[model samples]
Target: TPTTIPYVYAAEEDRCAPRHDVLIPSRMRFTGSTSFSVNVFNISLAGFACDALLQIHRGTRCWLTLPGLGALEASVVHHNNEGLGCAFENMLNPAVLDRYVAHYPVPETEELEA
Candidate 1:
């Protein structure tokens, strides 16, 4: 049997705006021209977290082009083997972010059926 560990929230978690878990697909390109596809795991007015194959160094500036949302400048804040965390250079408009989050894309099959 495998042991399960409990989860813990960070002390400063409440200081930041609430992060909403979403699966927004996007492309990220670094200043050096390195680019990769990333799935935005969560987003907030301040920043977002994404999972990507490449290893990005902290403080490296990048731009994310979200599907519905336009490109936004951001900086790498932290990273791990699985992905990197980033902070937007400018905070996103809450209304715009919320609208994008609420809009769900229709499946290809559903589109064909309709």
Candidate 2:
């Protein structure tokens, strides 16, 4: 059986903000690491989940640059072998999140793991 990597200590009930599924290309820079391209598969006012090939640990500071937006600051809250979940230092604007959902549509036929 595959070992499950536990996320940071927040309980499931703590995730009250709605999550929007999207497949948007963006840039991310982890502290002490250079910027790289990343695919933000899901997002919310508080955080986002993205594809991260690099090995990262919890509490890693990072900045994500979404299309048409400045780099949104966040910290790595959790990570598994394939991806990372990051919490924003400041909540994202709801209006911006709405625009992103409108711009990027994850093809319903394409089933994303996250």
Instruction: Identify the candidate with maximal lDDT.
Output: 2
List ranges where model 2 is wrong by over 4 Å.
1-13, 112-114
lDDT of 2 at 110: 55
Name the best candidate (by TM-score). Answer: 2
List the lowest-lDDT window of 10 residues for candidate 1: 6-15
- Per-residue CA lDDT of model 2 for 1-114, tens digit only, reads 976543333422388578888889999997788889999989988888899866677777899999989998888887786588888878888899899989987877656443
Q: Global lDDT of each model?
A: 0.72, 0.81
Candidate 1 pairs with clashing backbones: none
Specify the poorest-scoring 10-residue window by lDDT in model 2.
4-13
Cα lDDT tens digits, model 1, 12-47, are 244266777667788999987876798887777778
Q: What is the lDDT of residue 86 in candidate 1?
A: 79
